[model samples]
Target chain A: MSHADPVLEIRNVAKQYGQITALTGVNIQMFAGEIVALLGDNGAGKSTLMNIMCGALPPSSGEVLVRGEPITSLHHAQEMGIGMVYQDLALAHHLTVAENMFLGRELRSSGLAGTLGWLDSARMDRKATEEIAHLGISTLRDVRMPVRLLSGGQRQVAAIARALMWSKAALLLDEPTAALGPKQVALVLETIKTIAAKGMAVCLIAHDIPSVLAIADRLIILRRGRIVRTLPAAGQTVTSVVSMMVGENDDAAAA
Target chain B: MDRFRHPLLGGNTLWVLGLDVLLVIIFQLASANGAFLNPINVQAILTTYSQVMMLVIAQTMLLGAAQIDLSQGATAVLASVVAGTVLVSMSAGGDPGPHITLPVLFLVTIVVGLLAGVINGVLVGWLRINSLVATLGTLGIYLGTAQVITNGENLYGVPLSIQSAFGSVYLWRVPLSTLLAAVVVAVVWIQFRRGSFGTHTIAIGSSEKAAIRNGIDTRWHMVKLYSVAGALCGIAGAFDLARFTTTDIGGHGNDALAAISGAVIGGTSLFGGKVYFFGALLGALLALILQSGLVILRFPPFYQVIAIGFILILAVAIDSFRNRNEMR
Candidate 1:
């Protein structure tokens, strides 16, 4: 496939734990304004690939280029505008929504108070409100509400909002709908489309085939640490995707 | 309604305050002619526990960050011993022989405390030692060092002015040390409520992996927190020297227990990620009142220990119940 420029490019990425190889010779490229669904079973290397891309785990041998520049270290990846939303939704539940949105990168007050580590809560609240609105999330009424009080869908939105807030190049989401109800899943899926529509690269890792086929522009399938197929989402049915995922003939699996 | 439930000044502080008021009333009725309400007795209670209040503030921050320091009281004693020994030796060497002033002595004691805190911080924060075991081991070392320094005797001859200033001097009938403790509490309360440091600390306590992913230097922050705890202990040591005019080596036996219990009672969870400064202050006051009130009512002193032990268990049980509710 040809694109103007790729936002994230992984070339021949591999991961090994001593004698066991978790991933081998994986190649993938994510472009701007596209939703690429990473599909795989339990032992698949989807997590390993995502980890390497986000700098959480180093690849045994590979080159990861962000916006055409090589990057090392997770902090550098963040500085290069790559962000991830973990499956567990890494949020401090006791802190307010605004606080969680700006967890480590808090806005300090201007001048002396700021230098002394005072957070500018008003500005944070206002900014958080604007971002939530930008994402079309209306369920979260109060920016100052602690995250623990939020519903599952709202928490997922907040987590996605956090990743999108800092990620200028690409956003990686791992199992955005694993524990979510059907309604929440729809909300998250819609949010992901909105994020991609804003001209940012979105990589979604999920198992549910119908939902993945519903929102994904492209589908990348993984099996036994290898990319088995990369196909266009258009004109594809769940049966074909499942057959590809489980490496079985479509007619046999259906029978 | 939202304002009432505001996280900072809301449910926890109110509960602790209500408990404090109830205790005061009970003590008033239990004492002959309401002796527990006597101004002198009240002031004594506030002043006597002021040191523990200071220590509790430090413990609150430590416990909120999912760590504990059992060596705080021992560190205080070590700081006082180091400062007092230097002063005594300098004075014993006769006129103009490196005499140490109170300010210098105070500075020395604080430095000693900071050093001790750094050691604990490095062990727990950098070395990744289990906080309880590390601090417990340090507690023995610190206490042993203090004893060895003074040969099991008190280091006396603290300047009379220092004693009067920290002990007798009262601002509007409140001891200076108590006022100082209030200031420390206010400062800590503000940091816990409004500062990024406090937010980062709670975040670390909540999930270290999440905090790291969010770009927080968890180990560095942990080290800094332990160092701050040590510095506070040192300040408390200075106050101890000034109040009693001596560094009584073994006088701090119950301090760590009282401080930890008070912090726990104030809603600083052992599981971490939550702290209540005002609640902790009230918890310290409650312990002090219970002890002195029992004395006034002629109950055996051992009852104070029993009460404190019971309160610790009760606090933990309540915390676990609250956590369960949160999970649901």
Candidate 2:
């Protein structure tokens, strides 16, 4: 937390899809340059919270603010610098790495927007190649290779690279290491820490307690659409977090 | 074995291209005693490929995103009919009607294409209908409307000047259709190969949820894609009328089906997220070459249908296999 103000503020937000209450009255703040982990059981509304923040879904009630201003429109959310990378990576498998890097906003030569269209492939490729390298994913080869050919870790790296390149305000990653191998998971965790260290805020949604504990500066525990507790990760154990997550009384658990 | 199973091309494009070349060669050999390799024959081959190639490219854009417009051929048929009807009805039995000038007719084609496209887009994109079913239903509706407009009669009295602009027009030795196809394919290849919409469409096709989460308006892109497809089909229909001089109902359905086969054969995955315009061009040329060769060789005309059927089956099978492999 700094004098710069919180990057995101969720004020009493609730989301419901028909009869299913995905989230209820969630108030949370994410500061710049901090990695916040959102942990919950399957139905505890972690995704719902993240989705509302990312503007994928609107909150049934309450409001979300970026930089002290409320996010009123989808365009505002995008311009406010909130970026989300879903678990599936949302990458076009058939497209090359550089192409996927600029999925929505591509670099084009000036005249190319008109009749004589030309893509500054050299420029895009060079920047993408440099960014991927700067992100410590240098082992991957062939920027022109389709993403489908990349390993799960490489794909994650490419996706993170995409978010980092396009997003400056805040980045939200949903279970980034959910299906990755142990080594790849560690690589992703390191990337998360690096992102936070770069002065950009990050929200990581995670299921595995140990993995979340390893990198998170703070943890948000959601149980049944409500924020059960929020705590610093200074010396918390998985067992204590789990017990609190499941609503165990402190005295009863001590006994 | 591991290398073979990897997602990258394990000789699939090569295999398909080889088959395409082989079919072309075999057809040439059967027809004209393989003299189809001569320059004039080659020109003919290229000309036939030119007109439908634009439609193929347009269709490929939609198909690559996992959508099909059954009404595409109908849109083309109706555009031609509209032009003919407007021209003939305005005329006093001899002079071409002013209501159907070339520019106006062209404008009408574009507007109709866009309106028809909006209908398809609303049904599939907003209303959330299965694309194939919705497009098919619209296909029948459009065809019926075309019949109603024409009363089962072919509109043939298009002015020579109107027809000549698109029909008799040529750039050097190349037909306008061929040149247009080349330009379209080139432009689309560059746009999609290295442009924004290309990436957006692929992202949407690859994973709609992911695209939505990433703040890409997937629905709008889909509607735009359908609209573009309609526009292309409309233009092609205009050209077809110029080339054929009449809008007959029976043979046009095969054009849409052929375009799908061409798209699939071109390495644009039916499962979505991949588009190869060059491959689609090659696919269209291959299919057309085989059909033309069959006609020359005096084989059963239905052989074209069987060949296309086989191509479709093979393409679908390969797509499913590739999808399963990717899942693994």
Candidate 3:
């Protein structure tokens, strides 16, 4: 494995909600062209950490550095080429796929027509089609279909596509396959591979150990708001990872 | 398939249009000597409700954004009162009343109207007050201020030349005020249908949390939307002054209800995110036609109020049913 500079780094981030500590002194780094799976059991502060990294929630202490420069606010993160896809997939159901893809950043006509606020919908639709094709998303047959009509997996694909459209440095996906069926999960896994192959940093949060081992380069397991173990995925089995996650050697106990 | 879902035929605009045609047929069939279909009567009907149509357009924007403004009529009346007070003061030195130009009065009225709108916007958008309660409070404040200014009496003595210019000017047989309202509606329609502002408004109304995550400034956009509604009401106030040649506080009692009902009947939902401008216009015309038809049929004026109330209830019930299906 080549040792390269990290694209994103979270330094000693901590979060407190009144009397409870959701996360404390959490540190992580993401290098380009690799997928790092964030694994933890329930209430391990995985979501709180993700939210702080995505700029959705402010860390009570510590800072996030993108390409070695500190950033603040979700808008600032986006400007530095960091995109996040939430678990809910924030897609407007009434809008079409192309419209959702270009939401908040629509193209307008040139010169006087543009000045009059005439949307260049033809150009947007064409670009959306090209991008979806390039991304190898085949489930979305018609870009003009309202997002509400799309299957859950297709919606997930579209959300990822939208994030990738703006994110150049890092993509943070929160449980991208949590709600998908077996086939859809396989499809999303392939897309994640394609994303890493494109030289973008990918941070995936998932609970499925076999899928994570099959795809991730490194797995960092969290237990009660701290990174308990960082293991290379090349030779790790599900049994060994589960033992580490639960903080006990079940095989040793069985022997 | 897209054509089948075209907003014109398949959406709420269709019901408003159907109601409009039905009202016209009913009126024409009941009128002696086809009086309701007479061009003169049609012109009168069109002219009388032109100002209310403008207010309906304003209400549509608010409702589409999932906000409501009950203070629009009162805001317009306050704007007119401001203009009328100015003109009346200027005319006190002479027998023919004020010679203040229409442009100047319009400018003053629009400023006052916009100020009122901004205040409401600030309360509801910035302070995060519920829009219904915010506008309701402002409605009382604006109306009370107007009553204080006029001392609960009508303000008259507006220059006749100003009235003729705005109220009587016609192009190709249509009143200039109606034409002006049509232009406003057309511009608003384009903004709502094709502009970024409209897109953001719909997104905010659909799911404000989603819109916020996408980095849309929902609160600032709400302020702008309410301000625009206020500005439209100001323009309507200017037209109302021209049409009546007086600021009659009592005369505006039914305007808020009419505008809201018109917007609802035209298919603008009480729940935000969908707006049909043409539907609203047709809805306003439908109400006006029903009132006029009842008068011609020799029914007491009180029956007109009952008819309008019935229409409002029916339209809202149907809209909620349709929305439920769409959600499913």
TM-score, cand. 3 vs. native: 0.91
lDDT string for model 1 (A1-255, tens) is: 356789999999999999988999988889999999999888888988898998878889988889888779788888898989999889887677888899999998999988778889999999989998998878787988877778898899999998888878899999998888999999989999999998889998998888898999999999899999999999899888888888886447578
lDDT of 2 by residue, B263-297 (tens): 78767777677776656666767677777777777
Report the C-alpha lDDT of model 2 over A1-255, residue by residue, as the tens digit.
466688989999998899998888899988989999998788899988988898767899999998888887666776888777878887877667887787666667777353444466677788989887877666566677778878898899888888788778889999899888999998888888888888888998987889989999999999999998899987999998888777786558688
Model 3: TM-score for chain B: 0.93
The Cα error of candidate 3 at residue B224, in Å, is 1.1
Report the number of the highest-TM-score candidate: 1
Query: Candidates 1 and 3: which is better by TM-score?
Result: 1
Off by over 4 Å in 3: A1-3, A178-187, A207-215, A233-255, B1-10, B93-100
- Model 3 Cα lDDT, one tens digit per residue, B1-328: 1342345554478877887898889889988988888877877887877788779988988887788889988998999998888877766756342245587677888899889989998998789999999999999999999999999888887766667766777788888888888888888878776677777776776667767777778888888888888988888888888887788787776777788888888877777766777777788888788888888888887888888888889888888898777555
If ranked by lDDT, best first, what sequence of candidates would result? Answer: 1, 3, 2
lDDT value for model 2: 0.76
Models sorted by TM-score, best on top: 1, 3, 2
Each candidate's B-chain TM-score, in sequence, is: 0.92, 0.87, 0.93
Error of 3 at B38 (Å): 2.2
Q: Best-fitting candidate, measured by DockQ?
A: 1
lDDT, candidate 3, A1-255, per-residue tens: 345778899999998999898888888999999899988889988898888888778999999988888889888888898989999988876667787788888889788868999787788888888888888878887888777677778888888888888888999999999878899899889888988898899998998888898899999888888888887789999988888888786447677
Q: By the lDDT metric, which is better: model 1 or model 2?
A: 1
